[model samples]
Target: MSSETTAASMSTTTASQNPADPVLAGLKTQEAHPVSKKLRYADIGINLSDPVFRGNYHGKQSHEDDFTHVLRRALEAGCEKLMVTGSDLKQSTYAVQIAKDHPGLCYATVGVHPCSAKQFDSYRGGPSALLSAIGELAKRSKASGHTVAFGEIGLDYDRLFLTPKDQQLKYFEAQLDLAVEIQLPLFLHSRAASEDFERLVSARLPQLPKKGLVHSFTGSVEEMKRIVEMGLDVGVNGCSMKTEENIEVVRQIPLDRLQIETDGPWCEMRPSHASAKFLKDAPPLPKAVKKERFSPGFMVKGRNESATIPHVAYAIAKIKDISVEEVCEATWNNSIKMFGLGEVSK
Candidate 1:
């Protein structure tokens, strides 16, 4: 695929499938939600529906207000720091830009996403090129008031078109080496390749100098244990929160290993069972509705959601069956630990 296509794919995030207007109209005719779902926290994940909602939110609309705009929202939502992850050169560069624009409160990740590798021709041009590109990004990440991690670079069995598995592993291992060289933490993303994923890490575990996280995780209890053992953190996001294992894994994790994310402009979260009132049951404006898809009034919200972080805090508390304060503090600490945002953690 052309770089144009890759860039476009990265940019455009829309609803899954346009529904027929009549279907939506009919659903709306019978629309009467049994209960309202309220959002408690921001469970970050990757998505493609809202452009206005995309990017490292700094709070305002302009890029200049990055820190004040994006960081402020996260801060107000109780997010002390936000790590902006990247997929490939462009997005990674954008991420670094966001971090530089926002400074202290905003951080970044540098690496090629599994999905974007094909544009680079499975890095056929060579790994050296990627390394050099990453090195430049890493330098920018090290600039004043920056918090950086190497991430969104891992194996994804879910995306078959992106790369052959062997090539993906080669590139992933290379990024891991970069993470080791930089002595920075990592932000990992894995999908479907669970069976061999750990062994790949195990081979590298002995040589790796630093730890990292598997963002948007959905692994077995055994997998979770292996990750922790390797000195990595878990990016507890809303995407996997709906399943028994997602929340269940959290229950067993030590508080320090639990980090939270909204993967904003992307992944969606679930609503609190109690706060259904604020949630609209319809989809976007009817005119906004492309097809007759059944547009529910509302979906889940996150920490820095349509409301405040307390909702996410509440959601976390409920999922973990712990006090909101505990989840808040632990996640705060975990994020701090993962991104090297030390002083602000307390």
Candidate 2:
């Protein structure tokens, strides 16, 4: 696989840390990736609360200013709303704060990431205590009109080093139960544990909220079908288009059941995936988009940003032989339906 495709893998690491990652190195010098202008979209999952995206860059020291910069860029590119994801308690708190501060521009998810599930066992009062705390945060976020879902939570056997399977299950079920109890939609993750993931989700399907999403999905066609059959939406991003096989998987997903996201600073689409030759009727790159950096280190030339979601629409349109408008409209409506974005204003 190309370095760009590999760099799109979901992780908390920056491209600079991985010397071999060309995508990161290219960001410093590469031309900005093309994006469609006036494409109103919503990112189902983005970690705006992550420090790396907020840290000092371009002589800026204030994280709030850094966030505003990113959000403004996204607004200029047509990102209507951003769901800031929280994988653990600390990050969840940050997510809620960002959403609360921004109002309609941002929303927060409350739950522990599967990889960080070990924190439940290690913390005082164990899993129950963590759930209670997350519940409280969810309450506050909801009261502030910010919290939209319960997640970044699910099974991740692929990262066994981060949390054992047993502990992951314990935490996953607890959060699933909590989500159902609170009557909130879910923002879930699953990797290398499809069987258990399906089983667990199937077992809880009835109690869970009426709508939910499988964020950053990179699963088999069979798994995708199962998820759709269970009445859940599937999220697609740069990672979802890593290989031709992955592209084929995305092509099969019903547009209505699919939602698009940048999962920014990660999951960037490979250049080859959305080259000028393939982008039919795509508009010229915006001057500000080209001038902006996706993060403190990665320029718009390389790193993924919520603003670049149009590229995701472009790539999917190419693979599915559909128009970018169709992809954008369907995903936009799916996000609104699944997250009930309309209710936030009330």
Candidate 3:
């Protein structure tokens, strides 16, 4: 099918007309909800390597793998480019392979997540070997244009129970040094550890030209301003828009410095979210069924996919009172500028 047709089909809702008199209610529905144009989107942070996409949930195989179908849906929805997030060495390897399988359409990032910091200390080959493996994979994949950034790395005090403060701190700094040596931009994370996250990232910002983004940002407006002032971009996902305060901070984010992500299948937008009100006029998404009842073309319910990225843009547009096209264009450019994902087809 043509791109235009694919875009139009993204919204499955159709106007039902009365055969006797087809002019009033049907026309009103059409007018109130017109078909949206094909606006391009780049999902800058998606965990495509997550086992959930492959039908594994909580260590159990619940259904058949539908990874390719998810990618197809994302492309049809105008999310033409996706950056598969790599939280650690194993997942980073998987992410790189996914990128290789779908060049241009997909990309990858490589680094250890702060929550999984203890993996560094427990690796069979030792901490330095694990770090070296990540570095080698990043360097190789980057040279081939498969890997664009060097993270999913940073501080996360909220999940210190998973990895203590000292370990998280030590490895976060170690990974930052690796990013500096590799000379790649960052894909950072921070949750209630802004002070140290900022201190460490800022200390190295002078040497990193591309800088980086704090993906899935949920900090206060003042915290956001500090990040922007430090020359870093802010990435927004459903988790970033859960409340009124989050929406306000997103509104304050500079369009040029803003990027969008799914961070899925983790940050799915829900009905109770503050951002949901803005989506009243947004295009309807494709039909979804529970994961157990999954089919080839239907989205797995409760499992976030890149195809819903437009909903994110729609919410931001409504919050900022701007056109969705504006949001798409500015964010597409910002992502390309930051990650060098190359030109995207309009």
Candidate 4:
């Protein structure tokens, strides 16, 4: 795959390193595969958290500024808008700042991530406290008209930094309860906890939104079918988009039920020599990523190539074997619908 930044450039080498350096992670799926079949949906979820690899901060350095930059790039790439996910209280507030600043261009999902849920005394206290935490977030989301759903809210069995599974479970269920009470769609995340994730989701299946998505989904067709049956639009992004397993899954997923994303400033999509065209649409924005001399969302410069959003879109278009406009329009549409953009989808 083609990437603007090399692998070495993405992982932090030292604590003294610049925090603004754009760290790239990488992939896409969900709205559909055939270019003509992509329904132009919007990306309902995006990671605005600053990555803390080996304890060094390196995701979205300053939420407002970075978000503004990413928002512009997303819009330029043809996304009508997005629903942002915050990392924690501070980050969530910063996300709200972004939402308040750009009412139509951005939306937000409020919840402490599974990884960060431990730090919150409220989350640590119990479901009631978690609800209170969510309540505070809910108020802000309402105030900004951007709390599209409850999200970045799920289990991360893999990253058990300090929080235990039971604690994560409590935190997760608590957030899920909030979604049920508020009657909002959910922006979910699950890493190495699929079976547990399924049990949790299944228990609450009846209470969730008619439509939502499992962000950065990686699962077998059966698992996908289960979630799809529950009415969630599977979010297929760049990282998973290039894989054969992911591709095969994409080939199986019904077109209209799918969606796409960059998960930008993270999940950086690498362009393949074979599938160069599928990597367009993610414009490389590196105000902070300059230290590594790399851009996350797009492939690095050189070989007479520019890693712009349109370029990623082009790459996606070619990979799906569909027209560029179709890919753009459908994913854009999908985003709007997923985020409950309603009349604001324009």
Best-performing candidate as measured by lDDT: 3
Candidate 2 lDDT over 1-346, as tens digits, reads 2223222322222223443543333222333433434357788888876554544335453332234446655665667678989899888877776665566667899899999999998889976787899999887777667888999899998899999999999889888888887878889999989888888878887886556899998888898999999889999998888766777788899988999888877887665652333455554433322324333322444445776777777778888898788888888888887786644321
Off by over 4 Å in 3: 1-37, 344-346
What's the true lDDT of residue 18 in model 1?
A: 20
Deviation from native of the Cα of residue 195 in model 4, angstroms: 1.9
Q: Give all TM-scores, in the order shown.
A: 0.69, 0.81, 0.89, 0.70
Candidate 3 residue lDDT tens string, 74-104: 7667776899999988889878877775666
Q: Which model scores highest in TM-score?
A: 3
Over 4 Å off, model 2: 1-38, 56-65, 272-302, 343-346
Error of 3 at 195 (Å): 0.6
How many collisions per candidate? 41, 0, 0, 63
Predicted candidate 3, C-alpha RMSD:
9.2
Residue-wise lDDT of candidate 1 within 166-201, one digit each (tens)? Answer: 778777877777777776667788888866666666
Model 1, residue 153: C-alpha shift (Å): 1.0
Q: After superposition, how far is residue 41 of candidate 2 from its true place, in Å?
A: 0.4
* lDDT of model 4 at position 181: 75
Give lDDT for model 3.
Answer: 0.86
Give the runs in model 1 whose Cα sits over 4 Å from its true position. Answer: 1-72, 122-126, 143-147, 206-209, 271-310, 342-346
